[model samples]
Target chain A: MAKVYNFSSGPAVLPHSVLAEAQSELLDWHGSGMSVMEMSHRGKEFMEIIHDAEHDLRRLMAIPENYRVLFLQGGASQQFSMVPLNLLGEKKSVDVVNTGHWSKLAIKEAKHYAKVNVVASSEDRNFSYVPAEDTWQCDPNAAYLHYTSNETIGGLQFPFVPTPPEGVPLVCDMSSEFLSHEIDVNRFGLIYAGAQKNIGPSGLTVVIVREDLLDRALRITPTMLNYRVHADADSMYNTPATFPIYIAGLVLKWIEEQGGIKGIAARNEEKAGLLYHTIDSSGGFYSSHIETPFRSKMNVTFRLRDESLNDSFVSEAKKNGLVQLKGHRVVGGMRASIYNAMPIEGVKSLVHFMQDFARQHG
Target chain B: MAKVYNFSSGPAVLPHSVLAEAQSELLDWHGSGMSVMEMSHRGKEFMEIIHDAEHDLRRLMAIPENYRVLFLQGGASQQFSMVPLNLLGEKKSVDVVNTGHWSKLAIKEAKHYAKVNVVASSEDRNFSYVPAEDTWQCDPNAAYLHYTSNETIGGLQFPFVPTPPEGVPLVCDMSSEFLSHEIDVNRFGLIYAGAQKNIGPSGLTVVIVREDLLDRALRITPTMLNYRVHADADSMYNTPATFPIYIAGLVLKWIEEQGGIKGIAARNEEKAGLLYHTIDSSGGFYSSHIETPFRSKMNVTFRLRDESLNDSFVSEAKKNGLVQLKGHRVVGGMRASIYNAMPIEGVKSLVHFMQDFARQHG
Candidate 1:
């Protein structure tokens, strides 16, 4: 069976070369006579893998020396609580922008640790656009301003980074779009993403935080949940997701070979352009509610003109070897999550299928 | 090169068959054209993987209907805090037994959430023995009795299950010895094991708890850290460690093929017996501090008569294709963690090397 384009929002696609490399080394990594999964996280081989992964990521992101990159677990959902538990030290409140599903969940979890102020929201428009920065009610006294850089479910992405009040920091959940584009690392106080999307597999979450923000965890924070503890220990406070980290290293290397984030971003723009063009020229057969400027370059969401054709559209798409194209259940349409790992060819295949499906139903 | 016996404590060895299976399915799983790593957690393929993993684990452990088996992340270290955070309820204090490294860590973390009673400790003897239950200063009103079933670093295991005071539950950290031997499911209120040993891989932690214990989580507990949230969501409260869970399913299937826990236990006993006998009959050339009955059947810790040879001993062991035999740095000596996946032949090879080394250095 030929490989198909997998457009799952997360735990999403990975570079085929990385998977091939991992397969070749699955049993005896570097002639160590043990699978990467079997090596101790403290062992030299595994340590090297983790170090290279961090180093490559730091290079790719052009991360500053002031930032600490941590490989964590429990996905982005765990961070929804951990971010507040660690950063909301003396501050009683945090300013949050509810862009979509992920941001909403983050707001809910943060409320358990601190008073949450909804600074801005796109819910008024079904989360199809990013709220303007001037409309945001920035809390000068809040611990930080939190927002989702890209909402996988809604396929809406912030066009610009929001600046927090003078004393407050900015924290962004870049889960779906991390590494798909280059960004100024110094612009944010913290950025985190689950590895499944562009990094590698599930089980590992990458956290990039300014080093100065390490010491402010609440008194009740668990040692594992404390960012300071992880940073102090080099993310080895305990047994980490060792194999996932190894695979992520392979992915980081692949990205470098593809000419770093800049090259990858160019490809992502081209892929998104092709898919969005198909949606725009569908002659009323398909529609995308997201405003042109806010449509995600990573996840392109659209719907058939007739909702009744949704099931057959999905089934027939699968038959043609394009799978996981169904949008999030909440949005009720179709979404093609063309992350960094997604090839332009895959997007072209998807666009072709979308056109065919629309013509038959039209 | 032939596969070597991997003796790393956690992130230890897994069966070759499982690795082969994983490799074969690395790119296109079951003709689905998407790697298991790429599938969405909500997708049917990934759902089936998680469900089968939980189901097989339940069957292998003979876990009762009242128990909720959760596939969590952050290894066992996360549970060190979560256990107390969720189970302490209105009880201000909990009882803890200091067996070794893991238990001591658990005790330290539990203190952040609850007042801890050091009911009993083997720390006086350098954690070489399990303190007798009769000697325990039982806190009758404590929330739970927390203990380490097996200490990976010190190679000490409790010979008998410590009975908590009536109405108090027992919480055991079985990170190193889970599925190594069979025990009554009713013997403890909860059992949590990090999946690096005797299971699949790192990043996924399995928690088996009584259903009734789920609701008592502190209001301050992070939603992801709360057991009730995980139980209700079937451990899918967020995008879980999907690939790790799938690998765990494969491991569970392998254990079943090895005749379930009972058969695995008999093999474990035999393997551990052979290695321990080599140390015991070393004619004072090597020694184990653990009391014979309390010695762990998973991790076997010992030392050479002459400490000067420790480094060379480890190097020579690696040359003989017996690697990761060096003990944890905290405990300076040697530790062979022969988990469920370590074949009898691996133990035999280690025993052979031990005798040869003693013959030259004795």
Candidate 2:
């Protein structure tokens, strides 16, 4: 069957080979006489699947021995609430760098549980770039400093990890760009990512938190929402989304087959670089408002200079087997989310379509 | 490929045809050019999938317009916390009847958020039967009355719905018995089920709550845990368990093909009857202690009278293509969870194995 290049920001493109392998085993996984979904979560088959998923993720990210990897549900949005509930400890406030769309959501949820001290915000310039580090108002007495590594909607990337004052931990929501690139895991106190973007699918969230941070939940925290409850149970406090975890395990293997984090990052660099090059060299025909230094390689956003041609650009691109090129309504123009699974060929096909359309409408 | 009869409780069997159909469409659903797992939850394709799932479920169960159906996460265990937080309203206490292991868990979680009144408990009888309804000390001023429609671990089920005092709402955790048969949704203020039992898979949870009961959630309820938040957003408050919901929709259609709810109920009655009859006739060879009238059709728990035969029974059953017959530690017996997807043939096979083993060991 022919497959199209999918650029959906999330519930995004998955590795083609991984999908094929899952299809072949949908009815019987490794002669187990059951689909991955039908297996008991505590049964040996699923135990190994979850075990391997956490193992591979930890290996790929170089997660330290002091951290516990929790495969949780409820997306990064739920983490927005859990962050303050678990990490605020006895302190009453948290410092956050407001990069763009995703950070603003984190801030809103944080304010519900703690005093949010906005260290700095790039919103003053329509969020085109990350505000300079020297401008950030670090709170020495704050419990932690939080930031989004990648703002999936606005396509802005933080080029550097923010440093917190002594005794204050760092946290990040790396949903869009996790596993696409390598990073030092020791810097952050907690890191979480929704699987839909670059890992597997919706319904699974990966949280790697330093073991010491496990306690300190608020008095009113729901048991399920408390980090310690899940960590103690090895994430099996309940049936832990068996099917998605299986697929994530497969994705982890695919990540290794692509030669681990370094290889995936290089491939993502090639795909994003090609698409952005097409946008850049199109002269005034195509425009990207984000400052070049802080643009995201995961989600490449741009606009057709003649906005009236938007429908034709997206629809006509779909006709040529490139789909979901329309950007989020908040950012409104075009977004080509070229994650690790997006082959250079798909980005090339998108680039070819872009150049031809620009020539015709220039 | 040869398949075995799976008897694990909760993350149990799914209809074979549904699995096959999902396998066929795993790569490109309806030529949408992406796997169901890959489709954006907000996209048109996913919208249709979720819309049809809710429609078919409503049709099968005859759910009323006064209730809102939500596809959620965190499983039924999460609902333990959600129930007390959402249903306690202005009342100081809630009434509950403890039947088995599941009810006890619900009671434990409830005690954290509300004043819990244990109206009755069958635990005194080792949870082998439901305590007499006449003995229940229900509080008329309680916020709502809570019960477990079925206990998966003990294989005990309620033969009839319990009525709360006038104007005190009724809530039920029907996780293990939902969709095995139909019931009057009007009797309850809220009903929740984890889908792994009979619907689809582990990650997604199905919730049906009266719209009027939606507003009683405590202020501390996380936005994602609030029924009103999901109901208002049509369960897309954030990205839901997309793939599980799609598979659940397929299983709902399969239920219709197998003669809808009435047909399913009759089939369940026949399977449960055959297994129970076989156990009773075995005399000293096999035994089930649950008062026969209250035995669950979904999970049939039994034991070989000779305790030492336990390991061989499970291992032999596995060798013969019947698996996961080991019961929960609390029950100390064999449990064959013959859910909706479990064919009558699987039960017949178990019965045959039982009779043959009895003759050899007797």
Candidate 3:
């Protein structure tokens, strides 16, 4: 069978080597005589798996000594509520920049715990461009400023991290683009990412929070949702997502072997450039509405010149081993989510299919 | 290499067949050309997997049509707070029957949301037995009566389901023994189980709530913790634990092929009986503190006549392919957690080792 290039937003494609390694150890992990899935979270074998995963992630991201890396469950969506529940402190409101679907969801959940101030929103322009930092209304008394580093649905990535007002922390939802590039850990108070994209699987969520910010959780917050509880226990406040963490550890090792984050960033840029170049050179047959400067390097979104050909373009592309290229239901067209694990060859195959489909229809 | 018997409480042993099948399909699921982990939650492939899992679980448990089976993240420990947050609507308190460590944790979390009434408690006896249901102090105004069906740490299982007062609903945490026996779903207003034990892997939680009970979630409940939100979206409110859910689906299928819940219950009984008989025949060499009538059929806890030999007993058992027999750290002794997936052969091997260890130490 031909290997298919998966382009689903998330759960997205993973490195073939990681999957093969996991398959080999599915039933017996390191001669422990138990699948990573069946081993107790508190057992020595699983403890090492989780510990090594955290260590590798810290090394890859260059996380500071004071930051607590929490492997949580419930994906990034749960973090939307937990952020407010844990960080709202004495402040009555939070500042949020609405880039697209995910940021909006975060704002909605934050409103349940505190006053939500949508400082800036790109929705006015159909989320085709990110609002400039200068245009954002900073709230001096707000708890924190929140933003999505990349909008998976709109195919928009913030060109630069927003600078929050002095004393107010900056929190980022880096779910889709985490680990694709090097990041400065000191710049943000907290950073969270769902593992399905670049990390590993769907169940595990990676939360990196500064040490001093752990104690601000609301008293009514559930123990599992409290960052302090997780930080205090080293993210073993509960059983945790054992198998997912194990797989994520393997992915982190893979990242290191592939030249760490810097290497991943260079390859990612090349893949995005190749696909975007194809769209640009298609003589308007394939056009991208996103402003080039703010366009996502992870999810490349484009549209066929004749809207009627969209269905055929997607279906025909699947026959040639390109799958999950259909745009999000809310925004119809084409989207190639080239996450960290998507090789250069996969993007090239997608670009070739796009050009051939455009020429045939044109 | 010979297969070894695992007895960790959870994430405990899964059927070898389930692990083998998962290993074979880790890279490509049924020719979809994508690992189940890579499929989008909204895609038809994942939709089918989740739907089939929920359907099989409902059938196996004989769940009523009005019940909504929700596949949620955050283990049962998270449900500790969610229970009170969602069910303690107008009521200011909840009735709780404390059986062991898990029940104590639930009560601790419940106190954050509502006043907790200790209707009954076995903590007075070091959680060695279940408090009599007839002796429970019924709270007419309480939102619900919460109890743990099986205490994993103490190795105690409730012999009978507690009947809540006419208007009060019954809620149960069946985490450790969820699918090991036949359960009448109508007996309770809600049943929740962490999937690490009998279901599949860690991270995925199953909540079977009666339809009418969904609307009781408090206004302050986090969106992810709210049952109504999950029910409305059919448990796809956001990116779920995709791979965990898929593996759980396979587990449910395995349960069906083994002749459903009834078959699993009979096998569990035989396994538990064999282990208990071995302990009883050892006379003063082995002793179980839990009373025979209320002893668990899942986790068989016992202490050697010479308590100082605990370490060697565990080490010797491991050498003989019986692992994780050391008791929970909190309650030191030996605990063999024989869940639904533990075969009769594994139990026999464990019994044989226990007899030999007792003879040598006696």
lDDT score, candidate 3, position B356: 83
Question: Model 2, range A113-194, lDDT digits (tens) per residue?
Answer: 8899999998888889998889889999998899999999999998888888988899999999999888999999999999
Clashes of each: 0, 0, 0
Candidate 2 lDDT, tens digit per residue, B266-342? Answer: 99999999999989999778888899789999989998898899999999889889999999999887999999999
How well does candidate 1 match the true structure in TM-score terms? 0.99
lDDT of 1 by residue, A1-362 (tens): 67688888888889999999999989989888889999999999998999999999999999999999999998899899899999998889999999999999999999888899999998998998998899999889999999999998999998888888897889999999999888999989999999888898999999999998998999988888899999999999898999899999999999999999999999999999999999999998989999999999998999888999999998998888888988888998999999999888889888898888877778
Model 3 interface Cα RMSD in Å: 1.0
Residue range with the least summed lDDT across 10 consecutive positions in model 2 chain A: A1-10
TM-score of only chain B in every candidate structure: 0.99, 0.99, 0.98
Looking at model 3, residue B308 earns an lDDT score of 87
Separate DockQ for every predicted complex:
0.82, 0.78, 0.82
Residue-level error in angstroms, candidate 1, position A162: 1.5
Error of 3 at B126 (Å): 2.2
For candidate 1 chain A, the 10 contiguous residues with the lowest summed lDDT are A1-10
Which residue pairs collide in model 2, if any?
A: none
